[model samples]
Target chain A: MCFRDAAVRLRAQTIWSGVSLEVAPGEFVAVVGPNGAGKSTLIKAILGVHALSHGEASVLGLPPGQAGRRIGYLPQRRSFDASLRVRGVDIVRLGLDGNRWGTPLPVADRFRGSRRRDRERVAEVLELVGATSYATRPIGQTSGGEQQRLLIAQALVHDPELLLLDEPLDSLDLPNQAAIAAVISGICRDRGITVLIVAHDVNPILSYLDRVVYLARGRALSGPPSEVITSETLSQLYGTPIEVLHTSDGGLVVVGHPEAPAHHSDRHTGRTHERP
Target chain B: MIPSAGATGLSWNVADDVRQLFAQHFMVNALAAGTIVAILAGSVGWFMVLRRQSFAGHTLAVISFPGAAGATLLGVSATAGYFAASIAGALVIAAVPGTGRGRGYTNQSAVIGTAQAFALACGVLFVSLYGGFLDSLNGYLFGTFLGVSDRQVLTLLAVAVVVLATLALVGRMLLFATVDTDVAATRGVPTRLLSIVFLVLLGCAAAEVSQITGALLVFALLVMPAATAQQLTARPAVSLGLSVVLALVIVWLGLGVAYFSVYPVGFYVTTFGFAGYVLAASGRALITWAGTRRRATPAVTR
Candidate 1:
């Protein structure tokens, strides 16, 4: 995947501009940034749902949206209403043929042997996410972490060559965060599918990061975590005194970052606001 | 004619009532029409409730009032007018400038409300200008089930078939779009087009249902059955099928009861539909309450 000086604008405000980045095949990249830094806008551009004000983005040698079913996405976490009638396994099945035209006529499926094939695939993806126990349960009844796992199953049901996740760790507890991160990294290694995960904090995914694309103030800097996550890089990025601390437990933490803009934090929770 | 039961008022003879209900040709036509409307409304209203487009669907129902009234004044079939105006109303709603994201709800509602208000005014104007007979307006607004001709039933059947076939064709993709719009669009599901198409289908259902429950009470068939089924279950296929069954039951019961009473079919249908919804809602609440009590007792003992 490659973005050449891509820019996105909504209304009179320019969300971000002149951003460029590239990810090699089988790479796992994290997009970490403060609120209102246009991370979502960048994802929209790459998904080909939103037009860029300037420049271009391509996935697998084709324009963004043209990647079609080959690019799978796990959207931001929003609670499904309890009344939603779709089940956990059905959600995964949607990723398999949701974009295809025509009805998934049951009779046609029976004739073509696709129904059994689809059922097997859905089962495999559910097992991979460890959500098979409640696969028949309604999505609304599941916990946030369980729902996240199911959503990951949905994104992987199609076995896409490229997978993009928008805040796959939001609202999750620490253990869930670790589990989802592991699932994503495991998928990357097992399937050789390129992954780009956007998050407010990069710590949970630090262990698996092949590179980090940190965005601040309409600018993006991409490199290995050790190169871009230092005190010097983020301090310059946010125009404040920020410190990247290495803990004794083999985890990394960023300290002394400025308080986030009120609107920005309100819009996107789960950001790295810990002041330790 | 209601059969009297010795000293106990009305008899509860199911076999006789079933025979009497479809005794007349017009009654059979009404039964057939009701069946079609129930199935179409049940299917389409499921999507309407799921997408939270009930307000938009309600606006289209209101649009049918002026449509029928204008057709009456112009000496045309009210059914044709109902469909034409409601389809136009759907397009207008779809054309409203908003993607229904965070900031678009108020704008979309404003547009829908304005259209509804204007349509209501037009209906009043058209009714006032009609010189033939003012009582016909009541039938359009309140619905009349006693005099449905065979031709009208056929028309309803045709429209219902088209709507149901279209839904079957797009149901999967539409469900995906309704459940996870952003992800579906990102995966190339054409979410915009799907939404617009669903809106058009809602309009079609509204127009057909208005013929039985009237423009003012179209919700009797369009919303109640689907809402009740959704309240009762959380599986799409089961809920969808249950919605249709409930709708058919309501319509059948509504027509049967109206045959023996002085009230219109619309009133009975609306009453029965509302009753079903209330029953489902309270049933769910009761289950929750009982479960909570059970859990609380165990905690208290510990």
Candidate 2:
């Protein structure tokens, strides 16, 4: 995945601009930011769900949304409808053929070997995510962590080369957060799939991450955690006297930064912002 | 056979009465048309219920009233008017710009509510101007099974087939999108196109069902059966199939009751559908309560 001097604007206001980044295959990069940061926009841009105002971006040699099934995306945490009756495994099956347009005629596919193959693949993915026990359970009835695992399984079932997850750890407990991050990191290692994860907190994925793209005040600084999570780097990015305090457990906390505006422009309009 | 009913000269013979209900040509047409409408509404309405778009579905159904009335005033077939108006209504609702998923619901409901209000007013105005067809207007609003002709049955069949076939083609994607739209879109499911197409199909279903249940009572068939089925199962295929079966049962019973009585079929259909929904809801609640109590008892014993 690559973005060269990319910019995005919504309603004539620039949300972010002049952004450039690249991720090689098999790398796990976390796009972390403050509330108004353009992390989601960056994901949207790569997915082609949002148009870039300027610059260039390509995912798997195609522009954004054009990458089609080659890119697997687990969007920001959202609940399935309570009445949605699909099981965890069925959701994985959807990743295999959800985009295909054809009559869901059962008789035609009964004798097809590919159908059996798809089911095996789905079962394999469920086991990979440690969700085999709940594979037949309704998704809505599962816990948040379980549901997140199922969603990750869905994204990974097709074996995409690029996996983009938006805030997969949000609302999860610390243990669950660690477990999910570990599961994703394991998949990335085993499958050689590149990953870009949008996260509000950087601690859960700090160990597995190859790089961190920190966004604040419409600017981004990308490098290893030791290089980017320092007090000086984030303070400079946010234009504030932000302090990165190191916890006893070897975690980092960003403090003294201004509260983000309630309405995040990029989230609403799929635009990007740039530092003035 | 006491002389208590001699003044009315009416008797109840279940088998003969049922035979008589389907013996007439018009009655057969009504039965066929109602069956088709029930199936279409059940299939499409299940998705609408799952997507939480029942309000939008109701608005589209109500929009058919003015369409039918306007068609009468223009000396055109009410069916054509029903399709045009409901489809137009669906597009108008779909055109609302969704700022984001969280904020989109409020905007969509506001837009749909405004459209529904305007449609009701237009229906009233058209009815007053087309006074010559007041009886037909009443039929469209309250429903009449006796007036269904063979041609109408054929039209319903064609519309049902098209709607069902299109739904079959898009059902999987639609379910994925409806449940997890953000993820589905990023995976290249064409979520926007699916939304529009589903709404159009919903419009077709509403218009077709309104012929038998009337504009106001369309929800009786569209929402109730689906809601009931969902309450009973957490499996998509089972719920969808159950929705269709429940709808068919209610429609058949409603038509039979209306044939032997003086009331309109819509009344019986809506009542039966509502009853099914109530039963399903209470049964689900009872099972949940029992499960909770059972679990709690084990903990207390331990």
Candidate 3:
């Protein structure tokens, strides 16, 4: 996807301002920033959901909405009509296919398509995301972590060349985070699907990203992950010197404003709902 | 409930009467109205479930009651009164936030409760001026066909078709918007307009159900089939279709039971509809169990 000087404007405020960026084919990129940054907007703009008040953007050379059939997008969260109960596999089927009206159940006359036809494809994506065993579970019954993986699978089911994931790892534990990251990296490394993921902290996706774009205060900075993931650049972006921590578990890259009040991480341990 | 049939009709113990029943003027009118109302109820109720607005469905039913009663007192068209009150209530529901998962009925309940009380209070005032609503008032509260003319049935069918056609056209997108409305809007599914359209349809459905079964028995037309459809399937497309099918069956069955048992059709339909949901759930469990045994052993060909 190539986004040149793309800016998104909403009625109330400008989300992405004068944003110019490029994502090469098959590149694993992370559009990372703190809360309220234009990372989400920039992505939605590329997806053509939000109108670009400024520049041109394309996915695999086509406009975002036009390119939907070829691009897999995992939104922040996917909710369903409470009464429209569906199994996990069916959720992914919507993505695997051409992002059609919805995954309608088996009926006599309606033709079958790649979305569900990619049965083995569903299993492959499931295994990649470590949600293989939960395929039969109703999506509502799954835990947040499990649901996140199913969402990623739902994205991959279509087998799009470009995957845009917004906050895919939100509210996940470390193990689940690692699993999700591994699945994403595996897709980029093995399947040649370009990944553009959004995240709050850079530490989780640091190892997977070739490039990380930081957005703050309506401005953005982008470069190779190695050069861009730095305390000085982060401090300037946030306007406060931040600590760059290297966690004991061979993890590195965390930056936050020093003067700002430090908040506790709200991570908790919980299992995915075990459905009989 | 009130299971008394024609206390003065000669057809009391008539034998093997298909033509006698299906061809009767009153029977035809009842069947036509029930079928039309059932179709609209099933379709709109499908979205009501998707939007998780059963309470909205129920409250709108409550709010529209006094309209029909007021009309009865004023000797005007009950349908007109119900239509006005229902559309008003739909607008009120729209102003309430989080129509989705409206199990958060507390705030909406307060608003609806106030609306219901005010509407009924005004209706009581109207009734007093007229000095006796009598059987007509009972008809609006519980529902009796004593007041339904054939023209009313035709009018119900006309409104029913319009609502169904609009819903059918926007069927998929509406379902998409109903589930994760933000995503659907992001995908350019016209979220805001769809919400208004859906509420308007609800208003229309409420009016029809309110006029026929009275607002109290609107659930016979609105909630049951859709709720049963929810228990049966989770797919929007499937559940939508199932709701309609279930509604058709329930309406026919309820009408049948009402005829034999001599009761308000709404009472029989509502009770029977709840029974259907219970049956569907248990049937679903049984189907799952039987299917699992066939695939009990996972096979790895690779």
Candidate 4:
């Protein structure tokens, strides 16, 4: 699939500009950016919910709208209507096929057996995400972390070939975040599903990502982590000297102090060290 | 009043009115029309609660008053003017984007306010033109349940059945669209189509209910039942069933009460609906509180 020369503009803000990218089958890409960056916009544009003002985009060799069955999505945590006592099974079943509510389909295609299959698939996905114990529970009754796992299960229930996640762990605590990220990585890898996940930091997903794209201020840097996450690229993206340090704790940090103007000291220097 | 007839103290004749209710020409027509309006209101009210468009419901009712007022000033059936104005109001609001639009009810409020104001102005002008002791117009505005004609009732029933059936078939997609629109679109659910369908259904319901309850009074019967259902149950089917049941209870009760009082059924129904919502909400809270207390008690045991 191709996202060719894509640009997005809000009334008073520009999110993405002149960005081009390609996604292949079974690839897991991480999109990392700060707030107000174009990460989520990229996901939505690819889904065709938000049209690109300029250039063209396609999904799975088809336009986004036409690629419906192939793309599964997980949105960030938002409380659903409390009255919808939708069991985890029901939500996951939606991925397999939507809920029929008041409308019964015509005869010869009522999908009678589909109910059983949907339940089985729901169980399988719940098991995959360690949520089998609560698959029968109502979504509204679950905690935030629990709801997030269910959401992931819902996204994968149909066994879609491509998965798009919009900051899936933004609301979860640290332990849940690690748990969800691990589940995502294992499932995508085992199933050979292509994934594009957005998060504020790429470090949690750094090991599993085949490529990382950093979007900031309407511009972007994309490539393998080694190529695009360098200090020089990040500094330019943030409009400040950002230090990518191999800290004593064996972790990488991208830091820039806005108040400390003209002061540049990095334990690990790269490309060009700005003068103090 | 329907009476229980067995020593078992459990069974009762169901008024035998389901048949007789439709036997008399006026009853038959009023019921036919009522069924159509009920189904339309039921489905539209379902999504109206989902979209938090109760305000839209109220606004449409208010604005349609002017349409009725003007039509009646010339001694015409106000239904024609109401149907036209209601449809127009729904379409205009539907045309506006759903989010981040403006102050007061977003696009829903903005459309209602503008449409209603224009309607009120038109109504005054029409009244001025005719000037024939404009009490009939006022009565239509408030809705007279006794005024329900045979023809109007039949039309209401017809429309309701269609709306309810349509919702039944596309329900899965509609749910997907309402709960997680982004996900729904990605899965190719035709979210836009669902939206348009919802708007049209709502338009039809508003139009029919505008006849018996009057435009301004439809919400009492439309919104109350669904809202009450929301706090009472989480199951979609159950919620819908409860909504319809509650609306019927309130409307009929309001009608009965109106028979004993000077006020119209609309006033009584709205009051009853508001009280019903409060009661259901309180019940929900009580259950939640009890559950929490029960959980905390185990900590003390430990």
Candidate 5:
């Protein structure tokens, strides 16, 4: 996946401009930043949901959205209504053949082999995500971490070359976040699937990520986490006196200027300030 | 009108009553039409409820009222008007941007509500302008099995075939787009196009149900069966099948009871459907309550 001097403008305002980035196959990349950083917009632009105002972007050797069949995407966090009766396995199966024109034939048909293969693939992905136990249950009844696993399984059911997950770890508890991060990291390594994950907090997956793309103030910087998440780089990116602190356990904590109300409120609020 | 026939009154003998129920030509036509309407409405309403587009479905049903009334005033077939106006209303609703979320959903609801209100007003105006007989008006509003003809039965069948075929072709993709739209789009599902197509199909289903259950109580056949089925099961195939079966039973029972009573078929249909929904809902609640209590007892003992 590659972007060359790409820019996106929504409602006459530039979200991010002149952003150039590339990800190699099987690389685990994380897109991180503070609020209003257009992290999700970048994912959308890459997926061809949002058109770039300038420059060009490509995925899997084709233009954005052209290679959709070869891409698996998990959008930002969405809570299923408690009354929703859809099963997790069905959700996973949808990811495999949901775009097909007709419904699946019964087991008595000539296409029984293909149908079995579809079910097998769904089962395999569910197992890979460690959600096979509760996958038959209603998705709404599952815990947050379990639902996330099912969604990731859905994305992985059809073996895609590239996976784009927007905030897959959002709203998850710390242990579940680490566990999900490990699963994603394993998929990237074993299946040779390129992953671009958009996340707010980078602590949980810091050790597993191959690279980081940090965006702020409509600009982006991409490098190793160690280099890009430093005080100097983030402060430069934010255009303010932001601090990146290193704890004894090798985790990074980002603190913004206390007096700068616009950026400061987001650091501790836990509320995601989405781009309008 | 046909003269009063033998065995019109309900009897204690179950088989005899059923035989009497299917004896008449009009009864057969009504049964056929009701069955077709039930299958179409049940299948389409499953997706309607799943997508949370019941409001849009209701609006389409309301729009069919004006469509049928206007067609009557214009000396055209009411069925033709139903199709035309319902599809047009669907297009208008589809033209509004947004995929039923956030600010766009609010605007979409406002637009749908306004269209419904205008449709009701237009239906009243058309009825008043025609100054049709009170019986025909009542038939249009509350529905009548006696008025269902062999031609109407065939028309309903034709529409059902087309609608169900189209639904079968698009049902899988539609389900994916309905549940997980953003990801479906990213996976090449054409979410926008599917949305429009589903709405048009829903409009057709609503219009078809209106012909049987009447404009005022279309939800009786369209929503209740599917809603009740979802309460009974979480499995898509099972729930959808249950929805169709429930609809079939409701329509059959409604027709049978209305045949022997002074009340309209719509009242009977709506009453039976509501009863089914209430039963399913309470059954679900009872099961949940029992399971929680059992779990709580185990924990307390531990």
Candidate 6:
């Protein structure tokens, strides 16, 4: 996947501009930044849902959306009402044939083999994500981590070449976040599928990511995690004095100007001052 | 002329009353039209409730009031007005500039509410302009299954075939878009276009249901059965089929009961539907309570 001087504007406000980045096959990359850095917008632009105001982007050797059939996407987290009665397995199966024009027929057809193949694929992905135990349960009744796993299984059911996930770990606990990150990293390595994940905090996925694209102040800097996660780089990116502190366990904490606290925090609750 | 239940009243024999009910030609026509309306509304309403667009569905049903009234005023068939006004209202709602999320959703609801209110007012205006007796207006507003003609039954059947066929063609993609729109959009599903198509189909459903349950009580067919079925099961196909079955039961029983009484069919339909929904909801709650208690018992024993 590649972007050449890509820029996006919404309602006359330039979200981010002149952002050039590229990812190699099988690479696991994280797009991390403060809130309102347009990480989600970047994902949308790559998916061709949000048209770039300038420059261009290509995914899987084709223009964005043209290669949609081979690109799997998990949008930002959405809370399912407890009354929602859709089973987790059905959600996974939808990834396999949800885009098809017609409902599946119960009667045997010439394509019976393909129907069997589709069911097998859904089961395979569900097992892969460790959601087989609760696949038959209503998705809304599951815990947050369980739902996230089901969603990941849904994204992987079709075996796409490229996967774009927006905030897959937003509300998960630290352990679940680390586990999900490891699962995604394993998929990236074993299946050789390129991944672009948008995240609020970088610590959970820091160990597994091959590259990091840090966006802030209407700009982006992409490089190896080690090169771009330093205090100097982030401070420069935020256009403010920011400090990146490495913990004893190798996790990093970013703290900004005392009055304008940095937006990157592990616990993203009750802090509502971030810009959109 | 077919005999009215007023002559024989309802007998103690179950089979005999049913036989008497089906013996009337008008009753047969009502049942035929009701069956088609039930199936179409059941299937479509499943998605409508799933999408949480009951408000939009209600608005379309409300639009039918003005549509029927306007048609009556213009010396056209009230059915034509029901279709025309509801479809046009659907287009207007779909054209409203909003992504159906957050702020856009707020804007959409406001517009929909405005449209519904305006529609009701227009219905009253049309009725007054025509200087028609309140009896005809009551029929359109409260529905009349008594005088259903063969052509109306055929028309309802034709519309059901087309609507259900279109729904089948787009069912999978529509569910995908409704459940997880952003991902579906990235997957190249035309989420916006599908939403519009579903709304139009919903409009058609509202219009047809208005012909049976009346504009004010369309929810009797459009929401209750689907809601009850959903509460009973988590599987889409099973729940959808159950919705249809529940609708059929409600319509058949409601028509039967109404035939024996002085009340309109809409009253019995709404009553039976509400009863079913209450049963389903309470049953779900009871099961959840029992499960929690059972789980608690194990913890205490340990």
lDDT of each: 0.83, 0.82, 0.71, 0.69, 0.85, 0.86
TM-score of chain A of 4: 0.84
Task: Compare the candidates by DockQ and give the number of the best one.
Answer: 6
The DockQ scores of all candidates, in the order shown, are 0.55, 0.48, 0.28, 0.39, 0.68, 0.70
lDDT of 3 by residue, A1-276 (tens): 776776777887877666667778888999876666677788777787777887887778777778755777777644432234767776665444322443244562145554335667878888888898977766776776788888888777767888889877766777777778888999899999999998766677777788888787777878897666677777777787765767786466565653232331222113222222
**Which regions of candidate 1 fall more than 4 Å away from where they truly are?**
A4-20, A51-57, A102-112, A236-241, A256-264, A269-276, B1-13, B99-104, B131-134, B293-298
Docking quality (DockQ) of candidate 1: 0.55
Instruction: Write model 4 residue lDDT over A194-255, tens digit each, in one string.
Output: 98998865666777789888887788878898777778888887788887876574456676
Which stretches of model 2 miss by more than 4 angstroms? A16-18, A53-55, A83-86, A103-111, A235-243, A255-276, B1-18, B99-103, B132-134
Give the distance in Å from residue A134's predicted Cα in candidate 1 to where it truly belongs.
3.5
Pairs of colliding residues, candidate 1: none
lDDT value, residue B80 of candidate 5: 93
Candidate 5 docks with a DockQ of 0.68
Error of 1 at B115 (Å): 2.3
| TM-scores for the candidates | 0.90, 0.88, 0.79, 0.80, 0.93, 0.92
The numbered model that scores best in lDDT is 6
Error of 2 at A71 (Å): 1.1
**What is the lDDT for A28 in model 4?**
86
Q: What is the lDDT of residue B117 in candidate 3?
A: 76
For model 1, what is the C-alpha lDDT against the true structure?
0.83
Badly placed stretches (over 4 Å) of model 5 are A104-111, A257-276, B1-8, B99-104
For candidate 5, write residues B89-132 as lDDT tens digits: 99889888774331123578887898799998998889889997
lDDT of 4 by residue, B1-302 (tens): 11111113212244543443334454334444544555566557876786667766666666666666666665777777676667776776677676211122345566567767777677667756667436555555667665567666655666667877777778778866776676676676777777777766677677777777776678877787788887786655566677777877776656544544555556887888899999999998998999989999989999
* Tens-digit lDDT string for candidate 6 (A1-276): 999999999999999999999999999999987777889899888888789899989888888768877888898776566667999988988888899988644443235888888888888888788899999999878888888899999999889998989888887888898999988988998899999999988889899889999988789999999999988988888777888888999998878733344444433454212211
Docking class of 3: acceptable
